[model samples]
Target: MIERFRAGVLAAALTLLLTGCSAVMVPVSPADSSGLGRETVRVGIAYDSAGRGDKSFNDAAAAGIDRAKQELLIEASEAKTQAETDEARAEALRGLAAGGSNPVIAVGFLYATAVGTVAEEFPGTLFAIIDDDSVTADNVVSLLFSEEQGSYLVGVAAALATRKDRVAFVGGVDVALIHKFEAGYVAGVHSVDPGIRVDVRYLTRPPDFGGFSAPAKGKAAAARLIAGGADVVYAAAGGSGSGVFQAVAAGRKAWAIGVDSDQYATADEAVRSRILTSMLKRVDNGVFQEIQAFVKGDRAGGKKRYDLKVDGVGYATSNQQLGPYQSGMEKARYRILSGAVRVPVS
Candidate 1:
């Protein structure tokens, strides 16, 4: 089941400008009123450009915070990046940290530089950054994932499901992080059938993060791939995956794959049938566990890697269309976990 929850939005009057962006405080669940004396810790999340409604990467992170709000004695607030500039990201982090939010969480790799710069200024504050490990600090915890390992499993599914013996990968941005998805997918496709052709396209290049949020661009990219004979399409784009699904559905015979969250569960009923499977990147689990550690006074900071062996990343089999490929995907999963298959990150 895909757990969906929306954070109560504060009124515009409550919006506070920390630097140039607004940090809206989300109304969190009440603390435990029992005699256990539960102290509420304030948690802040700095979201990427797409924010909460992206239903992909940002939503996965929000799901984690929602889980924390329900299960832990905590208050939460979130600030989103308005501009692609590093200064804007730093300001979001600054605003959250300045407002007394401990263990401020940066939701995407885009915040790596901002987190490192802001962490130095707020030495007492604990910051956790997702999808990034470049920030090395006593107060920073890097939450990294084995994206290629999970992508490889989905690639295997795409390879097995393709009718034209041609598959395609749609990425939101042409960055090093997204390259891992493309590499694993290509590797997985070739593993199943060395003769099958795999095509890759990115919506936008670096510094222009709009690619993650542009559905039109995603649709156009997928449409082109489908026109070129791709029978199965995998999109690692953020919100843009929705467009890819639409294009795949219109293609009628093509299958679409989702990333980060189970797009099969979240997709529209019209397009849900076309989704073969999704690459599940458990960002929610990572965020919830980080919060749990913070609540227990275990704020030790370092790099924590979530991989196939730990069930941190895998393929979602929510759709019935994925049934035929389950055994093959499982075999691929085992191979990855057993170190027999070394997925490429480039």
Candidate 2:
């Protein structure tokens, strides 16, 4: 009977290893001989509501997890969100932790409450949350970014790239978090020339995270802004930002800015020509760094901040047409890092 039970355990472990880590189950593999050969570190990641293919925030986090998988040779598990509610989010975290996936990184601020609730149940598990710093747990580390700083750099680029001296901003949700993007963008545009115009709009309000996924709403908003004579539009609206890219492509002389990831490389070939630049948030680096630290027996806890000075956040230069503005963006970077300019969160 004991031998039958042992065989069952091995069979279950084999099944999980064969199925891959995209789902909730943990991967079972032989331990790495690098240091602790008896145990392999298992890291799990809970992605945001938009899931892994958003080509923005969630994908960036996944990049970090992939890096850890390759370099650390650690076992990994993943859970993608469906409903953005607190209960669903917490349930996802619970699934990963209960499956023996430690150092679970929840990819967005939406996971704060869920992570906090689930972390209490699994005190032995290490938790990391990105874009949220409010969770106060001894085992949880809040990964934050200086998004406003990066937004400011892109704002400067937009100001320089715009031929009409009029730009626009489109946000997915009307939340304080998205407002940070709006505020920094406006400040950056005004920094270049106070007379320049920045038209702004939000697709939806709080509790309606559908805004982030609704590309039609983004297209309508960008279309209206373009009709109003704004030549450059910046979108921080997750997947919905794809619509903004489409709108820019449709507009003959218009430019669109991407957020979270380097949309230039990630965007479709048809729209790549119009993407002026992207705000590089480096979510992947944060995720990988924390997991790497955990694997080294140095578990990272408390707040982990990524800012411009640390290369945690900045603007992309994938398009060569942005050559003229490169010098100015660098100067702006120097000013922000040297305390000559202070970018606001709101």
Candidate 3:
């Protein structure tokens, strides 16, 4: 039952979530980008405190691990988060190591401290940390993204789709990571419409929001904006964004833009058709490539940053049904990428 619940969260399904499910992850494959060398590797992934239910960042990371499982012949496991602790991360890594996994990968910057100390303690085990990298061992691989580029594109999408010149942005926590996304989106909005106004708000002021699992707050923040006459909202907040969709659904006239994976499918039937689009960070690609690289003796060393120019991030306008203004979004997306237009990255 616990496994079922975790799967439901990772699937980002608002409904059909079976009660009492535990977290379970099966990593993906390396078969897509050419043939895999003959080796069966096992990998472990850790989630932020929000767990997978928040359905944005953690889910995106899981997707990458899923890709590794499908393409690479490997065993995959997951560590459910209880808090931000090196002990929890180290324990997860230890489990992966015990299974003979050569290189265990940790998702999110929260895993940095865990990866840093654990990597040193287990010098034989290779490690990969996504989003933020450490100054530790040569055995670790860091995966970062060019979020500014994607944010710029999505910012344009928000500006184009916004009914009022007033748009808004909501983030999980007001940390540097969220700030990066905020900065990029703000730049994008300003580039298209200088006078465009965006009310920036974070679920928590700083350092924390333990219930990163709360979608209610997302709805509340979005509702305030909707009431304030803002017609478009971009939320980089995780599980809380489930509420953003609810707020968008209520507003009817407004639309919610999603992040990480395409969020169109993540919404309810009534509002899903209304989602402007999603800004994608191909984290799954990063995780999958890391596995392939390790297997083929080509793992990237030091800090690796993925950007729009490198195809690491982009916008997904394609969906079950393209939204009301798909073409405009596409044009803006290309313009930003090709340098024909510049979106602010903050």
Highest lDDT scorer = 1
Q: lDDT tens string, model 3, 71-145? A: 665567777656566787777777776766767878787778878877777777788888886545777889998
Q: Which stretches of candidate 1 lie over 4 Å from their true place?
A: 1-38
By summed lDDT, the worst window of 10 consecutive residues in model 3 runs over: 19-28
Residue 239 in candidate 3, Cα distance off native in Å: 1.1
Ranked candidates, highest TM-score first? 2, 1, 3
**Residue pairs that clash (backbone atoms under 3 angstroms), model 1:** none
After TM-score superposition, the amount by which residue 84's alpha carbon in candidate 2 deviates from its true location, in angstroms, is 2.3
Q: After superposition, how far is residue 205 of candidate 1 from its true place, in Å?
A: 0.8
Give lDDT for model 3. 0.75
**Best by TM-score, which number?**
2
How do all models score by TM-score? 0.88, 0.88, 0.82
lDDT of each: 0.89, 0.88, 0.75
Q: Tell me the tens digit of each residue's lDDT in model 2 across 77-185.
A: 9998767789999989999999989889898888889988998999988899998888898889988888899999999998988889899999989988888898999
Candidate 1 lDDT over 1-346, as tens digits, reads: 2232222233323333331132223333356343122335789999987888888999999999999887874779999998888999999999999998988999999899999999999998899999998999999999999999999999999889998999999999999999999999999999999999999999999768888999999999999999999999999999999999999999999999999999888899999999999999999999998988887666778999989877789888889868989999999988987889999999
> How much does candidate 3 score in TM-score?
0.82
